[model samples]
Target: MSILATTRTVARHRRLSRLELAAYIAQLEGQNTALIAGNTALAAQLDQAANDISGLSEDLRVARGENLRLDAALTATNARLANATSVGSLPQHVSTQPVPIVQRFESGPVLRAGASPLAAVTAPGKRGDVDKTQPLPVVTTT
Candidate 1:
């Protein structure tokens, strides 16, 4: 071909390549802008998650302290109860005398025979013809 025709052809090819390059650059710029916006949203979400974690950490610390305080209070209460029970219990060597047995019936409470107001009574089957080897059956009035 002649040099002039080749030059015109090269120029046209260059122009078309420049247009294609410009369109590709525009598409790349759009993708870059979308990436920047997505990165900004991700950063905001990360900051929110960090703030929530911080608040929850503080709450856990406070709850642990309260649990410790409650444990100490419970320990002190148990000790005090132990002391009070030990001091309030019945003392030994009060009396060895047996008290009278008062049997309760449907009508009212009645003193058993041979059981005085201040004296003691023998075993249930001792004075009766009941069996001495076998255990007596329990009786319920009410």
Candidate 2:
């Protein structure tokens, strides 16, 4: 072949190769653009999630502190409460004091309201089988 024609063909072939390389580079650039947009969206979502987690962690910390405070207050107040309450000390005062024993008894017959039934029961118009009406006695265990 003539040298001039050979050089022209070689130049044309190189131009075609350059065109193909440019098209491939353009396709990779388009893919990279799409990937950059996807990465940006993902970063935004991750940031929002991290913010939410921080808020929840703060709320949990506050709740734990409040619970500890309440527990300490309750412990202090319980320690301050009295073991027992009492009125003026007297022998009759002992008799008048409220019965602390819980009675689990079911209904025994109640009196008809106007008298003593036994040698001990006391009401309005009653003397028992004993010599005189006396106050119902209460026995206390020391």
Candidate 3:
């Protein structure tokens, strides 16, 4: 072909190639913008998750400390109860002799029928017999 016609054809081809390259570059830029937005959103979510984890960790620490305090208080209470029980035991010496059942009136003490004033009071046995004698312990509160 002629030289001018060949040069014009090469120029037209180069212009078309540059237009296609510019359109591709625009598409790549749009895709890059979308990727940057998505990365920012992901970073925000990661920051929120980290804050939540930190709050939960603090709550767990407080709960563990409260649990330890409650455990110690319970242990101390149990020890106090054990000591009180050991120290507040009943007296060992109790009167084995039964006391007389005397009903005192405004005037003086009276004895019922079938009961003597000098006779010792006896409690009934488990088998319905009145022969069992239970020891009575005198209690005095100061």
Candidate 4:
């Protein structure tokens, strides 16, 4: 009878301890559920950031390719202009005009078609042809 009373007391104490442990486990399970929810939200944000990064990388690649094309076109145009605008260094095989074009400046008189400005052929406001047989006065400015 004494042993049976001691066994019942211990069994009741064990049952109470099991109930306390179960409550503690339930609290930990609730915390785990909240932490899992937070982890899911963080994963979604990371995925969105990765997607934006990929889009920017593709745009940079396209811009670089366009810049390279424009650089190549500029180099070609410079070469073509350098070839066309040569003053005296043209190729020997490529035939060009040999006659030199002389540009005269206006200083004293306006003469045209082989008429010399040193010899006065016609006066101003007179409609007359150039006279080659004339000896004009020589004015010297030392």
Candidate 5:
């Protein structure tokens, strides 16, 4: 009877140990699942940030290009102003000819075809006769 009682006690202990181990395993699996979810969320956020950074970088490049173009134009205008101030002290008289289109180069402002050279020919009062039937010349510049 004493031996039989000891066998029954050992069997009860083994059953309790198995139950504890199963509970521990279940808890560990739950923690692992939570960690995997957190990692996925973090990866998604990192991908979004990378995309935003690339977009901002492209915008910065475009802005820089536009700024360079505007700076060149401003520099050209300032040079033209300085040249005008150095050439003559008095203001020149305003002529009645059409306002000429000015092109700026590194050297200076280039006079267009119908500008200062032909000012005398194209004055408002001394203008030549316009043949209305004639087609206007189409000019192309490279």
Candidate 6:
């Protein structure tokens, strides 16, 4: 071939190669952009999953605390039941003394003008007009 024709052919081949390289670079850029977006979405999902796990861990901790409280209550109830059963197994004996049934009437504390509000409670049925038909009131001292 003539020198000018050969130079033209080489120039055309180089231009074609440059266009192919540019197209390949553009395709790689597009793929990189898609990969970056996918990575960002996956990272968000991972963060959400981590938050969910943290919440579940807190719930599990609360449940464990509640279970421990229930277990303590169960232990106390079982102890009481054991004590009651043991008491039931003991011999029963009636008391020799007759139990008296006492009756009582309660009155609000009387306020004398100068007296402190924390005054002591008085004996019941101390009022003079009490009828003999009613049983005498019992006085309780603390």
In TM-score terms, which candidate is top? 6
Candidate 2: tens digits of C-alpha lDDT, residues 1-142: 9999999999887775767989999999999999999999999999999999999999999999999999999987776553233334345535564555443112233344444444443433665443433344444544
Candidate 3 vs 4: which has more TM-score: 3
By lDDT, the best candidate is: 4
lDDT of 5 by residue, 1-142 (tens): 6999999988887774777989999999999999999999999999999999999999999999999999999999999899878845455574334433442332344556655533544445555743323223333343
Ordered by TM-score, highest first, the candidates read 6, 1, 5, 3, 4, 2
TM-scores, one per candidate: 0.45, 0.40, 0.42, 0.40, 0.43, 0.46
lDDT of 4 by residue, 53-129 (tens): 99999999999999999999999999889879977777887656443323223224444645654555655457775
The CA root-mean-square deviation of candidate 3, after full C-alpha superposition on the true structure, stands at 13.4
Candidate 3 weakest lDDT stretch, 10 residues: 133-142
Off by over 4 Å in 6: 1-16, 86-89, 92-142
Q: Which stretches of candidate 1 lie over 4 Å from their true place?
A: 1-16, 79-142
Q: What lDDT score belongs to each candidate, Candidate 1 first? A: 0.72, 0.69, 0.72, 0.74, 0.72, 0.71
In candidate 6, what are the lDDT values of residues 1-142, reduced to their tens digit?
Answer: 9999999999887774767989999999999999999999999999999999999999999999999999999999999899889845555563344434331235234345433333333334576643323233445432
lDDT of 1 by residue, 26-70 (tens): 999999999999999999999999999999999999999999999
Regions of model 4 farther than 4 Å from truth: 1-31, 82-130, 133-142
List the lowest-lDDT window of 10 residues for candidate 1: 130-139
| Global fold similarity of model 6 (TM-score) | 0.46
1-142 per-residue lDDT for model 3 (tens digits):
8999999999887774767989999999999999999999999999999999999999999999999999999999999888778845646675444444331232344445445443444433445545423233343322
Residue 23's C-alpha lDDT in candidate 1?
Answer: 96
Candidate that beats the other on TM-score, 5 or 6, i.e. the better one: 6
Indicate the residue-level lDDT of 29 in model 6: 100
